[model samples]
Target: MNRYDHKGVSHYEFLERLHRWLNPRTYLEIGTLKGGTLRLASCPTICIDPEFQLDVSSAANREVTLFYQKTSDRFFQDHSPSALLNGPVDLGFLDGLHEAETLLRDFANLEKHCRSNSVIAIHDCIPMDVGQTTRINNGGLWTGDVWKVVPILKEYRPDISIFVFDAHPTGLVCCTNLDHGNTILDGMYGEIWRTWRSTELSDYGFSRLIEEANIISTSRVETPEEMRRYFWL
Candidate 1:
């Protein structure tokens, strides 16, 4: 019943395709190291990061694009890029902190600026193993329990639609149907973070979380095509 094939496409390709097809008016990225992913945005954009280690001269050339060398917490504390954007967050990417608590906070902050049509892509959700999901950076590629934020939003914020797909190295989670006015997840940030921090998931628990959240894999053709149509122009 779907129409598009998302096979053989890298995350960069997928993002570029979305930008080309959707032609969003504004974009935001939480982690803008070196500007690799941030460069893919085709609209007026905002990049937030505490530090940078890459040459973003090309990205900086975009007169509409603004770079804030600050943590998400610090950036959202008083600043609002959506006020300057044409629409309530056309698209956003969250790739900072790599911790569930920090990610949850970022998601909550982004939600304040997102509309129902806005889409958010979160990187490094499906870790290869338990060690990769640990709080400490013990592995070569650190995801750092950021995967937990998916289910946290799924269970607590059912108003939104959540999707996960294989993007190599780790994974990607795409969320839409956002409600900027929802206050259910407000004011309980510390409590939610503490609860999820204390909760440990077994392998089975992980599978259950995926199922409960209805996370379909791109390894399956049906999921990708459905997502394509969901975001179709």
Candidate 2:
């Protein structure tokens, strides 16, 4: 029996696979945390976080990988992700504020810097349980309100394609069908926040979100080499 039948690949492995396939020159990640994820990129990387506890022990210390100690909100307001990249951001990760509203805002901002080939991955989309999705942030495996963005994107931005990798712990959502010129989300930002900003999911309701998201499990990847095929083919 395949181990992936009962378990998914770790998020780190999933990310590394994506980077290996994309071979992007620029990567921008929100929420640096301990630099565990940041270390995976051997390309130009920009990590933004208000507070980062970095550990570069077994990580790539690329001269191009930079840390911007600022909130995503401030970072976007003051700096351009593409400017740092000097072109479109090939790979962008939204692992910052776990709130749905914040995540939505980050997604919109990131989209402004994306080209047709861009893929932006949003983390913490799968909450462990009802308690884990709450805004209070109590549970050991809390996912916060980030899951709300799944359906929001599906409803408002039908042009975009959303896929969940279902990696270890929370999981990752990769978005394609990027439109740098799209302004629908920005226009409806307030209404979206009002709709999904304070969502609380029960056990049954949580399953519905998965159904609504139409997320693909990492088991679809089959093997590390197959990831490139899975994403592109």
Candidate 3:
């Protein structure tokens, strides 16, 4: 039950032990820019943010509730009421408007107000395929087209279970296999998102995943020719 903030440490300690073993009632959070993960989430939070322009009175004095939909697909395509959702939110934190078609239409408009074991955490789905990088896709959580909505949610929800929680500069997908785990909190499920194939992204398979991500990003320092052969120590 630890939700440390300072904005880092992989999914806030497993999202605070899955929000204290799923004690959720409703806490949908698309992207509360300055709320710091909505004060490390607990419950009763609804922060949409379509250019919310902050100063929300310190996030409404910490009661944590604000919705300024400028375009969650035109507010759930005009179904309004912040998208006709008034129940069964439980947990859904996609870091808002991250391209790839608005993060796959905000997960198909929050998958119709999710519930049957609700918990959808998707943010910056790690996919920076080498250089030519141009960031600023804030609404697409920094492009990579939000990993193409995980194969459209595994071809229309095949009892989801994709994992990947690097938590660095925002990277977490965790869908959690619903069915085979028998839904909700049962055995406290955990397996965040993961899956790959697009002909394994060829072009010599993305030039060997960018040459193995540049040899694991230059395999740390301590030896870049021992500091370029000690330029003069």
- Report lDDT (CA) for all predictions: 0.74, 0.79, 0.50
**Per-residue accuracy of model 3 over 28-86 as CA lDDT, tens digit each:** 77777666666666456667767765643444434546465566666566553323346
Query: Against the true structure, whose TM-score is highest?
Result: 2
Where's the lowest-lDDT run of ten residues in candidate 3? 212-221
By TM-score, is 2 or 3 better? 2
Please write out the lDDT profile of model 2 over residues 57-120, one tens digit for every residue. 4236565776789999999999988887788888888898888888999999999998877889
Model 1 over residues 1-233: C-alpha lDDT tens digits?
11112233466665665676667778899998988888787678888899976675645535588778889999999698678675588888899898788888888899889888788888887665555677888759777888788778877988888777655656677888888888777776776777777765554366565455444545453344555665632
Q: TM-score, each model?
A: 0.85, 0.90, 0.29
RMSD to the true structure for each prediction, in A, is 4.9, 3.6, 18.6
Q: Order the candidates by lDDT, highest first.
A: 2, 1, 3
**Model 2, which residues run further than 4 Å from truth?**
1-6, 57-61, 222-225, 229-233
lDDT of 2: 0.79
In terms of TM-score, which candidate is stronger, 1 or 3? 1
Instruction: List candidate 3 segments past 4 Å from native.
Output: 1-24, 28-31, 35-43, 46-54, 61-89, 96-142, 155-157, 160-233
Sort by TM-score, top down from the best: 2, 1, 3
Colliding pairs, model 1: none
Candidate 3, residue 74: Cα displacement in angstroms equals 33
